[model samples]
Target: MPDIVFKSVPFSKEDVTLALESGVDGIITDAAHVDGVRTLALCDVWAEADMPSVALGSKAEEESIAARIASGERLVLAQGWEIIPVENLLAQPAVAGKLAVEAASLTEARLAAGILECGVPTIVVLPEALSSLKSIVAELKLSQGALSLGKATVTEVRTVGLGHRVCVDTLTLMERGQGMLIGNSSAFTFLVHAETEHNEYVAARPFRINAGGVHAYAVMPGDKTCYVGELRSGDEVLIVNADGRTSLATVGRIKTEVRPMLMISAEMETPDGVRSGAVFLQNAETIRLVRSDGTPVSVVALRPGDEIVCRADVAGRHFGMRVQENIREI
Candidate 1:
């Protein structure tokens, strides 16, 4: 995630308050208003006149800016810096976490932060973009890397008597194709669709995902994984959509109850030949998985050859963190 700075140069109190309320990382104001902004919030206040702003209109300037950043200088990007120069600076060795760009709009901010999948370390938003500040913050802050989701053919689905299942109630209401990724192993995970649909028997609990058995592993933000049994209120979970886009959601509560359980097994073709994965979910009408067409398929209706979305990776997770070692999971 990149830092978001709001530029309130010439000092508009309304704009500064908007920036503070929008949860910006810092506020860039003239030296005279640094105290004013500080009084508003304890966030970082950058002296606009003290920072060096360079316009990379030529190769010579680009090289100079890149060299300055390589030498540990935190430089701000002036207007008229093109995409080519930005890419060139990003490509320079040892220049990570040393660059800043002033974005004029949310689109530009998103592009600046999404460049090379590692954007500039800081984004300064001009006051002209006040209307889009909240949007810019929410997207650049909440968004995670798009995952690599593929299809797996269901091989079996069988009842496993009574067991404890976990229902993850999130602070955000998920849509039809949005849910959590869960599995017995971190490497092979299945997309467990949330309880967003309503039927005659039950009302829609769009903010809940009756995720799976307590022992299942859920893929979370920051490349981490957490067991469903260990999750608690106020924890963060990654909500993944069928298209692989992910966003962060706070765990409002964790509900564990004894229910009739079902085990779902699937197989997918991998570079190391076919690999299998399994997840234990509650045997209920609301428990579902994502299909190839982005529709939710109930676990009770799953059959052999039914293709569902899944993610496969190298099989190793040490204490919920990915590790590279010669380890086998059965």
Candidate 2:
């Protein structure tokens, strides 16, 4: 996540209050205001006098600032900064994650974020533009993190009788090979492909995923997971692709109904050894899981020895949050 610092110069108590409530990472204000800001919010408050600043008026000055950043100075605000100088500094291997730019408006913030495609890891926003702080922060944080997906070979598939299955309808239209991560255990999850590919019998539903049984866990943003039964409309879910890239999608609807379910189990080869996991999903022709080649394989057609993509983790979760505990789920 990128750091969002509120510049509280010409400090207004109301603006500081707004910044603190908006979930900004820190506040940069005058030394006299530091104590007052601290009294209101428990966040990093840096006195303006303590921060080093550089005027990017010349190439030499920009290079000097980059050198200082490379030598381990983590926070330096760039004034009169432009795309080229920021790009140049960012291109340097040593200054990759140490730069912060002052952004005057939402447009400037967007430019700062999209520079070099990775953007600066921090941005100091002027106090007057605090009204746009939330949206700006959201735009910066929406850049999805990547996941490491591995191959899992189908070991078993069997009818599991009738059970309640969940169909998640997201507001975002998903591609043919994208969907949510779901499984019985949080440690191992299957990339249950979206119902976007048309079949001879059923029309394509590009926004829906017949995820799994009600008790199954679906991956959420920030490395969390929630039971499919717990999800509701307006909730945010993580939509992942075959290549492990992810983005946030809002849940528009959740349909839970009795359906014939199938228990699908697979084994994955890991550095430690082979690990096995399973998910019970609707036993329908349209329900599918993602294959390694970025194609959707129908659950009805899945057979032993077929390879698919899955994610595994060692941490256990409680109430969708990661927790340290010796826990197991079948």
Candidate 3:
């Protein structure tokens, strides 16, 4: 996500308050108002006197700014910054995180964010654009990017008696082919389809995913995973579509109870060989896994040799954070 800074020069208390409420990363204001801004909310405060402005229309000026940035000066580029200069500066390895741009409107902000496909990390929004700050921040932060999804062939599906299963209820209504990626191992995750399809027995639950056992790993943002048991209300989880496009969803509720569990085993074809993983989910008609064609197949109705959507990685995880290790779980 890009760092958003609100320019509070001409100092409007309302703008400062809006910035605070909008969750901006920092506030650029005069030193006298720093304390007042802090009294409203705690955030990074950049004194107006300390920020140096650089005219970045030419390559020579950009080089000068780059030199100052190398010396630990967080200089701000003047507004009306063209795309070529920003791209040139972004291409330099030394200017990775040392630059900020002043954006007068949302278009400039988006342009700064898309430069070189990895735009400037920080953007200072003028007070005039404070009214649109909330939308700007949401647009920058909610980008989920893409996910690497693979195919896994089902090998077994059998009942494992009664066990505790977790049902994740998210705030967003998922589409027909959208769900969470979960499994017994962090290296391999199955696309456990959402309960959005209606059945003769139960109504459609577009916001619920009968995830899996408490021990299973549910994919989280930042390429991390968390145990189903660790998820709680207000926590963010990754909602993946059948095409591997992902988005963020907030957990609204987590239901755990003793239910008959079904163990599913599947093998994924990797460059080395076929690797297998398993997930234990509730043995109920409502619980389903995604087929390769984006169809939902209930756990109770699943059979061997069925092709399902899954994701496999070689890196192991420790305490939900990915780590390099030669560990295996089955």
Candidate 4:
């Protein structure tokens, strides 16, 4: 993940507090208040004089910036930085994790983080950018990158006996096709639809996803997964849309209840072969899986050969993070 640092040259305690609260990784302050800022919080503090912002006006400056970063110098890019110069610098070799860009607004910060697909290693938010610090961090840091999703055909749907299922109640309201990715394995998962569709029997609870059995793996931010049973209030869960766009939301509450469950199995053609995956979900009228057209289908009505959206990958996860070592879930 790219880092966000706020520049507090004139030094406002309130601004520093806001930056820290907004989840910035570091703060660049002047020398006089180094001790004073340290007293406020245990965050990274750098003297403004030591690490100054570098302006990129010509081709030579790009080489100088790259050489400085390559030779073990940490640089914070000056405000008003352009796209071409950064793109040129990113094209050079060995430039990851050593460069930072000072952004005057959220727009620049977002653009800086997405340059050349990999983006800058760090972002420096100026004082003028403090107003939107929360938004900046939420997009650049909290919102994890893209998730690949595709359609899969359902092969089996069977009723499992009563079991504990998790209902993730997030603070964000979801749309029709927005929900969490959950399954027995992190590699092969289903997009369990959110409770956004209104029915005559029940009103929409757009913030909740009655995810799956307690033992299921729920995909999380940072390309990680967490067991549904272990989810708690305040933990972050990845919210995925049918289009594979992702957003971050805090789990306001976790509702675990004993409910009749259904075991759903699906398969999709992959480059390797026909890949299969399964998920255990509550067998209720409201619980749904997304269709390829971004529509929601109830689990009770889902039939064999019915195409629904799923995510498939190589089957190995070590403590939620993807790894190459061989492993299986059945």
- TM-score rank, highest first? 1, 4, 3, 2
**Lowest lDDT 10-mer window, candidate 4?**
90-99
- lDDT, residue 195, candidate 2: 91
lDDT at residue 290 of model 2 (Cα atoms)? 87
Q: Specify the poorest-scoring 10-residue window by lDDT in model 2.
A: 71-80
Please give each candidate's TM-score.
Answer: 0.82, 0.65, 0.74, 0.75
Q: Highest lDDT: which candidate? A: 4
Q: What do the candidate models score in CA lDDT, each in turn?
A: 0.89, 0.87, 0.87, 0.90
Q: Least accurate stretch of 10 residues (summed lDDT) in model 1?
A: 48-57
Question: Is 3 or 4 the stronger prediction by lDDT?
Answer: 4
Q: Can you list the residue pairs that collide in candidate 2?
A: none
What lDDT would candidate 4 get against the real structure? 0.90
What is candidate 3's lDDT per residue for 1-330, written digit by digit as tens?
A: 689999999788988888888879989898888878877877888788777557888878988988888888888998878888887777778887777999988888888888877788999999878778987786676658779888899999998899888999999888888999999988888999999999788999999999989989999998799999999999999999888988888999999999989999999998878888999999888889999898888888889999999998775888888888888676
Clashes of each: 0, 0, 0, 0
Which residue pairs does candidate 1 place in steric collision? none
Residue 277's C-alpha lDDT in candidate 4?
A: 86
Per-residue lDDT value at 30 in model 2: 85
Clashing pairs in 3: none
Report the lDDT tens digits of candidate 1 across residue range 27-118.
Answer: 88889889878989889887887665778789898888888888877678975567878887888768766789888899899889878877
- Local lDDT at 54 for model 4: 88
lDDT of 2: 0.87
